[model samples]
Target: MAAPRVSVFPSPQELGPALAQLVAERAAGGGDRFSLGLSGGSLVGLLARDLPAAITGPATTGPAAPARWLLAFCDERLVPLEHPESTAGAYQTQLLPRLPGPPPRVLTPATGLPPAAAAEEYAGQLRQAFPGDDVPVFDLLVLGVGPDGHTCSLFPDHPLLQEEDKIVAALTDSPKPPPERITFTLPVLNAARSVVFVATGGSKAQILKRILEGGEEQPLPAARVRPASGELLWFLDEAAAKELNIPVEKHSVL
Candidate 1:
């Protein structure tokens, strides 16, 4: 696995646009269709604020067009679309509308079904969307690191962490709220062309140190996310990077 590229910003204010720029560049350089996985949390606010800003300009016909993108949530709460906890709902209302040209195709989990059934249904959606691959390989996956080192709905020390058979798995005990959720398994996360983890605030500092430097025997959920044959990145604000000792690219305000 390749080592992650760590970029530290003065604050999330600066990190947001930088993250957006990276997305724009990835979308511009990849295949005709760009498949992207998204995670929730503060990342929602960050991307919703800066992604559209970074993607500005007239929508021209090209591989980089937003119309060709496929947007899927890395994990989603089993709640009504209007519910506050719904990741899909947040993006629909906030991020999608702001992008230029025709909107991207979005795949959302069936919130009405039971957890196991929902996971199965969502897996079927991915299979249809990426028919050629046994495991769907997304072009870019935007993930977040929980203070507990969780990513997606896979919490630390959870049995879900051992999951390898399912592309999507359901969890009833999320440690974090809403309890029930469907998340992409590590196989899918590791299959991405690029994985970027955005973490901010002082609450993330200690765990960032352990995840980036400790190299534990049993790695944290976030630490275990090393994309196979793909690039891994960590975008941290100064507050979150305070405890780190390794070399990092320090970004300035644009």
Candidate 2:
């Protein structure tokens, strides 16, 4: 895995617009369609509040056509779309409204299905959207790391870490809540054209140190998310990166 390119911000509030700008930059690269993978957590709220500012395009050349943005989940709770914990529900209620135009296509698993069944169904949806035996590489992925260094639903010391064949896999008894879930496997996660982890808060400091400075032998799920042919970046707030030993570069949306 390559060393992550780090972007540090003084606070989560400042990090939001920078993250939004990065997405706009990726989308502006001229794709017929832009596929974005979104993970659940505080990122949901941050993007909802700040991403819209970058969406004011039509009048100016900013991003790929707003209508071409196809958002998908990296992992999701196995709950009804109406459920408060549902990631898709939260994005629909929160982020979509922040966009300047009508919502783009959103691919989500059928609610109430068994975890395994839901995973297969979601994988099928991905295959149909981006077909072929090779992994479906997303245009950009905005992710979050749990305090335990988990990304998506893949947790520490979990067998799912070695998962290679399936694009998506189901999980049960996750260390975190909403136990039953479906997640995009590492192969797909690592194949994204660009991957960024949006981490904030002092609570993330220790794990940030571990994932960024620890040896590869001691791999954390979040650290495993290295894009093979694309960019791997970490956007952190000062509180989240305090424990790191490495230097950090600052960024601007401008």
Q: If scored against the real structure, what TM-score would every candidate get? A: 0.97, 0.95
Query: Which one is best on TM-score?
Result: 1
Task: For residue 141, give model 1's deviation from the true position in Å.
Answer: 0.4
Q: How close is candidate 2 to the true structure, as a TM-score?
A: 0.95
Question: Candidate 1 on 142-243: residue-level lDDT in tens?
Answer: 999988999999899999999999999999888888999999999999999999999999999999999999659989999889899999999999999999
The deviation in Å at residue 8 for candidate 1 is 0.4
Q: By lDDT, who's the top model here?
A: 1
Cα lDDT tens digits for candidate 2, 162-231: 9999999999888888899999999998898899998999999999999998786869999888899888
RMSD of 1: 1.0
